[model samples]
Target: MRRPGSVRTLLSCLSATSLSVGLMALGGGAALAAPDTPPAAAKPMPAQVVAPYFETWTGQSPAELAAASGNKYLTLAFLQTAVPGSCTAYWDGETGRPISKDTFGRDIAQMQARGGNAVPSFGGWSADTTGTELADSCTDVDAIAAVFKSLVTTYGITRIDLDIEGDSIDNAAGIDRRNKAIAKVERWAERTGHSVQFSYTLPTSTTGLQANGLAVLRNAVDNGARVDVVNLMTFDYYDGAPHDMAADTATAAAGLHDQLAALYPKKSSTRLWNMIGVIEMPGIDDYGPEETFTTEDAVTVGKWAAAKGINTLSFWALQRDNGGCVGTGGSDSCSGIAQDTWYFSHTFEALTAPHHPHH
Candidate 1:
């Protein structure tokens, strides 16, 4: 389910499987060049942060909206190459929008100044299905790793979210390469004393992650990729049935907790719960009238997520937290149900407290 502004900058994604031929030299850009200026000391996100997806393609400043919506941290969405087979990634796949302080540097810094940081997310639905995703289009593991390192140096962000969906979930070769790059990045982070965490945002069935989604994480574990979080997009079930949106959110997360337990049996129940994240499709999702999340659901889930101590509680997007378009499904601008603007943000952002003491 591609977002409204997804198709504006897309190119055919040719499968370029050169495979892990060891570490390859980074392509042009600061991927290999030393930073023009020294990066300041980093301010990592809180262990429990509510970072809703911020749509970069909408020509809106994430910092401006975060301030208006009372959200400090935002997960900037969809960084990939404009063209497939290109190792170099750009925000929203825009060639002119390469990573630099001139781009989102000022805004990201402002968020950090306020005790929050922007976590850049890569590979949205359009990129995943089209093969423009960094790991899918570019087969060079080293180049992929280099780009990730640059994000840390340029923005001082502590976490990266990988929103793998559709075709990319089943890409065995891409999964292997991505996990290899993650291992490399982790090693680099350890040496440089940077706290970098990777979260995989995968689509889930009502029960749990389907087979393809599981395969992605399995490869990560096999390749020694430290998965700090497993975020599930709990919207857009598309089963064409009326749903108890809030209850379904609970069941879906519970199923994921079981899956995480199976994946890492050594971890305790609290740790497995902490490793989880859920994205609610506020208002109506892409499945028309079959799926809807209400304002009451937001309040309920916020309290539930904090009590359960889930690492993250986010929505499909920050921009869609309003009631501008009633009965709409998947509108990029507003939530399709009746509610005040920024209602969801106001409800969920409080969970960022490092210690969310339960009542």
Candidate 2:
């Protein structure tokens, strides 16, 4: 489902500030002309890098993860509630889930140890919580603002990613609701005078009416959200048989890139980050009983995205494939479908290697 190549073409078309402004307006920002000063020549695109908003789950200690990953640019905690339970703001530690506040402190400590940035991600695939509810109850605009202030004060997190997903998108009145929620968060951050980065994860493709998809992103930006990066779900494109992993990722990325380019031109500032799904969920679709992705396939997808100028590549999960799954032969083997995970790390290293252009 990840189409990096197509996204690249979309990036190419965004050469005019008016178009960029237009797309921003579509996302909900008021239009402004490109600055009158001659814009500086575009900086050479850096070699694609891994913006690992590392997903931390139950049984994994933040301290351990910091040691393992060596503290990257962004570390994210994937918080969720079991089925039939409504969303809650804090992590249910008793249930092994870390609350936002808890995760924030632990992650900050880990980042300090590992030397990378840590931020809290509110939701995941099963997260059905609404931003409005989070803002209204747990922390009002001012309190929420204060919380972030404390985060910067205590742990020095420079970014915060809002990874809300699932049916909650459909609950929105329109793009405006999503934009307003994000705007509230952004305004709070701004009021605190912190240069915090904001990002979101939408649906992989245009399948649902859920606001967590591309259409919702288009509407959110059109209304007034000031999100910095839009990370598209590039995996889970097929359900049945294992689809051609590279092809699907490229297609998803390309499609998303094109859509954004059409809507916003010349705004390369809004970078496109690709999410590659490495977890092999079988029997869910036509992809057969079970199948796993190869590391080579993951690398191919990354290479394709970079060739097209889409520099960011993130993997869906970190834990699922630690042991090989269905189509991957034996458990713990890194060959066959299991290779997909191995390739993800390898590809990231290769892409971000020193002297590599397009970082």
Candidate 3:
């Protein structure tokens, strides 16, 4: 389920329990004493990266989706974070107290069997177990970093995403803690010779990333973290309708480009663009009919992202990539708009060149 409003709006309503550990910290970046060091070059991706959001706990299993699509989609992002009290990542609503590798091992194996990859996402709207919350609960930052490393190594995935939002995004203390822990995680990867990539999934307004959103990026560099990509949830703009969904998303992405230019002054303009991404909620959004992201909108955004050489292109979910629930209000089961199954996915996939690798 989506939040009642944009993350910024929800920040004010959190209580002490939640505030003790939050995720969104919109404060201006604290000036660091050390001169900024050029961030390590993000690991090279295929000619074009087209990874779609795969809701592992939703409509169908990763293998099922991949089979049905005839392996047209090779990379899928599994939705979610692990349990809150422990470092283990598990599917939301499962009864297991301490989740283990078996929790999702079968599904992971199934996807990999079909030549597909899973990007483990931390934190989403439907769960209380956020990435920051998971990190805050840990006594040792290394332990938290270990959890991330273990998961990455276990799953054979080269990339991971931190979707910080809602109460999780508002917690300044939690934000710092999470950044530090992730920095350590990157360090571990470097020292162990484990190649890994990191991306942050954040909310945004039409103009660009909100104050706290910007802080999340700055803090990464300030804490000596390597962020491969800054992904924007380019949907639900303040929970209202926008004049043009595609244009609004592109404008916000452009705004982010300028912000990154300042954050990494030495990086070339093209490299900065490659360090950015856009994640959209196709079709009718939870906000209501006022905002409709049509298949055409996907094409528009795809073309712009491709032309701009953006690092990644994905959407809110693959479960809703069908037209079964058109105009049925917001639904996790479908995009709530009329469209053939896999149409939206195919549209976005077209953004990449034909030679780009796909399983």
Candidate 4:
């Protein structure tokens, strides 16, 4: 129940294809820098450590998010367009509206008051260069970078996630444009003396590179762009095919780890920040009668990922699966509120807890 335009703030999309390709290339090239001798085993931390993906439009107050998530790290979605000294376009829910810098500042203050981190994200699905476009034109990288700098300074945010999506990655110019944008952002960070971290959401499959998006990421890294992490969108690959949830999660995690390790050896530790979906896609029916992820299913996947040394996990949404569909009356329906609750609470517990019974 986000106010009409709330969600737009989190509507940015990132191309998954580009990220996979870049990581693959880096992983394949050189042996990562390693100490000659093996390092000692590091003890695992508690399992309650979890990162929650939040939609700007959920209309939920910052206090509500903090309460539901138990003060875990929350990634607030897309901050679409930025006007020089004016307002920025954000989605409260579905409606797009211009919001002032001060208003956004107040929102962040509220989030911080709840013991949460508020990170601004850019780019998202349906980014047809209209509502949430970062730059007026592709070549306006400097301008875009300036806007990002302004956002960080204005809101006192330290991390920024870029979620570029769509067909803008189909040509040489597109790739260059994207790369320049990344570089510009990096330059801004360096000059401003801020620890502005950058991450991108890319396609899960490496084969999806022919789309030109992957090429953009590869070129960016090749040219020395500072990308801290890559979040791989692994779901949504269903094509009317039956999928084994546990097995698919395992395979995808393993494959992504291997590929990313091989491509970007230097940044191998920054492997797939796997995107798990809790909501059912509109047209897909392969994930059983009622789609979505269950608590047991989430735990299974979390265990599998933990065993493989993949630590970062982000759900597609926090508000969408608010433990509401738990006891609606049918086998196909969700198990109960406990399921949704465990899906997150347990997943966090699993992540932060010691790894006694290894996956």
lDDT of each: 0.79, 0.43, 0.64, 0.46
Can you give the lDDT of residue 323 in candidate 1?
Answer: 92
Q: How much does each candidate deviate from the true structure in C-alpha RMSD? A: 6.8, 12.9, 9.7, 12.2
Best by TM-score: 1
Least well predicted 10-residue stretch by lDDT in candidate 3: 8-17
Instruction: State the lDDT at 103 in candidate 3.
Output: 45
**Clash count, candidate 4:** 49
Give the alpha carbon lDDT tens digit for every residue of 143-187 in model 3: 667767765555555677777776666666667767888888788
Which ranges of candidate 3 are over 4 A from the true structure? 1-4, 7-47, 70-85, 93-101, 113-115, 128-132, 355-359
Clashes of 1: 0
Query: For model 1, where is the 10-residue window of minimal lDDT?
Result: 9-18
Q: Can you give the lDDT of residue 201 in candidate 4? A: 59
Candidate 2 lDDT score at position 311: 49
- In model 3, what lDDT does residue 87 have? 52
Q: Would you give me the overall lDDT of model 4?
A: 0.46
Question: Model 2 off-target regions past 4 Å?
Answer: 1-49, 52-55, 69-74, 80-88, 92-107, 129-154, 174-178, 206-212, 238-242, 266-291, 321-343, 357-359
**How big is the positional error of residue 357 in model 3, measured in Å on the Cα after superposition?**
15
Tens-digit lDDT track of model 1 for 82-198: 788999998777766787776677778778777788999988777887789999999999999999988998888889999887677778899999999999999888877787899
Per-residue lDDT tens digits of candidate 4, residues 1-359?
A: 11121112123232211112111111121122132211111111122234555655434454366565564455666555433222233432122233333234455555555444555666655442343345433346565566566555555555666665453334355456556766876776566455566666554432222234345557777767766555555444433455544555566555555555545665534333332211111111222333334556666766766555554456555554445564432121123344444245446446545444664
**Model 1: residues >4 Å from true position, as ranges?**
1-38, 353-357
Q: How many angstroms is residue 159 displaced in model 3 relative to the true structure, after the best TM-score fit? A: 0.7
